[model samples]
Target: MPCWYYDKKELRETPSILDGISFETERRYRKEGARFIMECGTKMGLGHNTMATGVVYFHRFYMFHSFRSFPRYVTACCCLFFAGKVEETPKKCRDIIKTARGILNDNYFYSFGEDPKEEVMTLERILLQTIKFDLQVEHPYTFLLKYAKCFKGDQQKLQKMVQMAWNFVNDSLSTVVCLQWEPEIIAVALIHLASKLSKFTVQDWEGRQPQHQRWWDMFVSDVTMEILEDICHQVLDLYQSTQKETHQSSSPPQKPPSRAESPTAVKSTNSTVIMLSSVQQQQPPPVSGNGNLQEVNNIQSIKSLAGGVPVLSSGDAPSLPQGPTPPGQSHGYHLYHAPPPPPPPVVPNVPYPTSAWGVQQTLPPPPMPPSLPPGPSGFYSTGGRQQQQRY
Candidate 1:
């Protein structure tokens, strides 16, 4: 097998498309590819070791190949194809191609020709060359089981912790941590994480010790607390990032405005109005008292009334001022007509000696003279003719 390494400075510069992709995107791609590999392996009734080895093969190949040049799904199928043969549980090339096509569908398979078998065969050659035919991969699962046996505890509880650690090992393959750390280091870290989750403490079994002595000291003398802690943090971070992505993708999409409510359309309308206003202000006042002058004043009043509310263009100014047209002319000139004359000033409701037309037709009766005495008879002193006439 050949040795592979990357320069930290060069990776930070992100020289290629593969390096340019975000860590989250790469992790998701790797995870999805691994899932497909497992699905294909399951369909062929391969054992767990075979499926795991296939996923390892997939990861090892991508360290050299860019996702842009060769897609993950195709490479995934090739990994399983090669893994199947190496693990001594060989599957036919046609059967593997057929199963992959069925699971992934035709759209996902990249092919040079119409036949998917040809593509798989080509991918296998490239995969073999990429890894330099290194088929022996040490998985963390074996080490995890070995370390679990050292813990002296209830068989049931220990079994549960071991199972949890096994799951962590499987999930860790999605991360690049596996490539960076040894299998034994990852196995110990996973067991530590699982122990915390399961509330199973090693101190209870091993008893307290001085600062120099620790639990990992018993099984692997070289492993330190710092190394185990780093691995655990990496695994935990992966889970946290995955959860966040799931929440974001599951959220409802925001609704955009309809055409009528669009801000761009509204802004365009306001701009048009402002332009028209500016043009009107620049022109000299239309000849005073002319029909066009009154129309211009009405347009200004309409602008004030609109209060930035966009309306019809300047051509529609004639329809804005509301009133009946003057008798001979087709339109009225009064842009600001005073209200009607205020209804004849509201007189008191008392009667007056006036005729129907509101003009005085008769005078009021004159007052009688105070000097005249009250008399039932005609004036006696006036003449003797009164002797025979009644008084």
Candidate 2:
């Protein structure tokens, strides 16, 4: 019942982005990290789910950590190494590191540090803690295939559309869409996007009816064109992004110095650069000041909050009345209720968790009221088993 979904604002202003790294730069870092995970997973013969889960962990880990502090590629390796075990496609840490080394250039590979296996193992621990050990991540891939099955279309065309949607789902790992929406929602939106791009119209579906003319309605009732458009645009942005060069476009242009001032400016700039370099080298990445998941550290507390199972509060305790009662009324609060045989309290109508855990979280039936066991005087007086009062 732990909610992992966050808003676009949180995604835009991640810890790395707040630590002097631009949002675009952080995003590119995520993409490159995801790419690294995918390529490593594939080369290691891991399944799509394993790689996707690893990429998801990579994204979520950076939510609390920073790209400036941690090498994204190294973290990517750790995620894949961790994700393999979670997804049951377990791979050795050395194998993963070796695969990463083979794929990365010498400069990039140096990020692994000496004893790369140990580095990845250490990061694996941090990655586990960073993601709050919410290891079971859902991707758009499963939902895409499931929904594609429901579509009433030509077999080959449907195959192509589903394949395209599947590819879209894979591409989406590079984006923050997983952090923004549920897998089902992402699947629906991508399928809609794919259908349009592939020119495949959904004339009917498994649950064809007057009210259910649309396909998404069957899976997700509240899906809209705008929401779908936003999702599609996020995924499409990757295509546009891929075409663009990965240059430092966001850097500020240096001002030219005059001949008379050039030497002084050069010395001043050199000194300033040295000072800044030293400071940057020593300074750790900045932590984000605010977000919905500011501190998603405690697993139990998050689950309890999600479950709306609050700890006992003063408001729930029975308080004594402050003022005297009128002459016509009794001072006892229970006098008017005839509590000799009180009716059971009505359970409040709280919402069930709207996630996979919902079905598994069914409440147990209320226990039957205990009958009065005969005392020495042939009557019982208190609640609980054997007159043992429960807190």
Deviation (Å) of 220 in candidate 1:
2.8
Query: Highest TM-score: which candidate?
Result: 2
Give the local distance difference test score of model 2. 0.63
TM-score of each: 0.58, 0.63
Off by over 4 Å in 1: 4-20, 110-113, 204-212, 252-391
**CA lDDT of each candidate?**
0.56, 0.63
For candidate 2, lDDT tens digit of each residue in 160-261?
667667777777887888888899999999888767655678888786667885778877888778888898788767654542321112223255432212
Off by over 4 Å in 2: 246-391
Candidate 2, 76: how far from true, in Å?
0.3
Once model 2 is optimally superposed onto the true structure by TM-score, how far is the C-alpha of residue 163 displaced, in angstroms?
A: 0.9
Model 1 per-residue lDDT tens digits across residues 1-391: 4653334343333222345665445565676677667667777898767878888888777777666567677788788888888888989877777676555432243232345567789888888888887777778888887767667777776776676677667657656665667787788898887677555666543433465375666556688777788777766665445434333333432554322121111111111111122232532122111112233332222222111111112221112235654322222211222343447454343434643212232322333423433344533332233322233
